[model samples]
Structure formats: C-alpha cells, structure tokens
Target: MKRILPQPLMSLCLWLGWLLLAQSLAPGDLLLGAVLALALPLWTVRFWTEPARIRRPHLLLPYLAVLLWDITLANLIVARLILGPVRCLRPAFIRVPLDLDSDLAIVVLAHTLSLTPGTVSIHLSPDRRVLLIHALDVEDQADLVARIKQRYEQPLKEIFAC
Candidate 1:
C-alpha cells in the first residue's frame, strides 16, 4: 500500500545501487539494501508531495549538450579573467526569475547554475521565486537574464514543468 511503500523507482534504484556498490551479493546485504531503498523514499516522500513528471525526455539530450558546452566556455572565461595579464572582469548580480515551480526542478536549476564555473547561485528568495546569480563577468544584465531564462529555464520548464 501507499502508506508503507514509497516510490517504486527509488526502491529499484536502491536495490541496484547497493548491489553495484557492495560488489558482492549476500542475503544480509540484499535485505539491507532493500530496506534502505524503501525507507529512504518513504522518508523523502514529504519533500515531494507530488511526484516530478518530466514531459519531454528527448529534450534532455540537447539540454545536457548545451550545459556541457557552457561549462567549458565558463571555465575558459574564468581562467582568463583570473590568470591573464590583468583582471578586466565585469562582475555583477543578476536576478533570474523562475517559471518552473517544482522544488526538485528549482533545486537542480540552482545547483546547475552554481556548478558552472564563474557563476554562483547566491540565493533564492524566501518565496522560492527568483534566483540571485553572481556572475564573474557580465556585459549586460538584460542579456544575461534573458540567456539564463532562455537557455536553462525554458528547457527545464518543458522537461519538468509540462
């Protein structure tokens, strides 16, 4: 029943993850993995009262490709700014408003933004509405905000927001 069992996918992942991690299969290990897998999802259920529903799986490939490219570009830009002859950096704050409402999706977006070099997700407003991102260099606020909204938020919205 839903009362005891949690997300089925989580349980399956728990089982496989433990198997791969432990590298040996014993009865005790199997039982422990199963128990942990089930328990974790049950505990995490509160975090997502409603399950995440990704609408377009195909879009993920292109999204990931772009993110990877951005990572490389960002790393280069940051390195140049730091190690070059002079730091002709343009640092500034940009507020990115969210169209994706789900907590999981928003957290992923925040983390992804933070992970990219030269940029950091500084804060998300208490209402979980707008994200404050610190860019190591910036040419224009409008372009940056528009880029974030268009490049990341739009695809994420299509994928996770329906």
Candidate 2:
C-alpha cells in the first residue's frame, strides 16, 4: 500500500511541478505530464527516502499559514532595513538553546527559522538540540529568543510532541 500510493502521488507532484515550470497546459504537454506522472517516481526509487509522516494533519494548514505570514512580515522588515539610506543593521549571532527535543520538531524549527527573511539557521549542535542563529536585526537577543520559543517552538511541541 505504501509503495503504491506514495509512488503515484510523488509522480503526480513531479508532473505538476514540471507543468508549472513550463507554464503551459497544451495537449502534447498533457501527454508528457501523464507519462511523467507514471514514470518519474519509478525511475527515482533508490534516490528517495520515505517522507516524514506528519502525525497531525489538522495542524498542517495552520502551520502553513503561520509560516506564510511570518515570511511576509520578515521580508518587509528586512527590505525596510536594506532600502533605507542609512541601514540601522544590528547584526548578531545568538546561540539559542532549544527545549523541543524531538528530531521532527527541531527540523521544523530550523526550516522555519531559515525560511524567515532575515534570520538564518547557521548551525545545529552535534547533539541536534542547540541552534546557532544569525539574525540580521538583533535588537535584543532575549526578545528574539523569546519570540522564537513562543511563536514557533511552543506550537511545534504541541503539534508534534504533546
């Protein structure tokens, strides 16, 4: 069952991605898309790992929404700093110790942080718990840490752990 459906779904997404990149939906392209929808995953089996199985499907959209909004806001803030005649950039590297220990939670946290405009996930400790983040504008490291904990890590714990 896993092999059957996951393969097809993967193929379908690959097909859709190709279509999107091409920006056309003509009849010949449709045929090629159908071929890709059946062939790509079969050809790429050894390269693919089993995807991370998200436990809470209900949290999916809300998580996406949170990420989208954060990305937009972060982009605007970063743009303002960059476009200003005098850039008031207070760049700082902060070591944020994380309490959410689950590997999935950590993955989400790292990805979320990197996705935001001005923040980059510089490094994760060997133990995979502590994250070293670089913020483009770090007014107060404490406030940034608090925001990361409250806005992302807390909800990640609830969604993935609790």
Specify the highest-lDDT model's number: 1
Residue by residue across 1-162, what tens digits does model 2's lDDT show? 656545754576678887997789998887898787777666676765545445565876787798899999999988888887796689999988889767767877999999999998999999877899999988899999999998888878777763
Tens-digit lDDT track for model 1 on 1-162? 776775776678788999889887999889999899889988888887677566677888899999999999989978888888885688998899888888767887898899899889999999988999999889998998898889988888888853
TM-score of each: 0.76, 0.74
| lDDT scores in order | 0.85, 0.81
Top-scoring candidate (TM-score): 1
User: Which lDDT value does model 1 have at 136?
Assistant: 88
Query: In candidate 1, which residue pairs clash?
Result: none
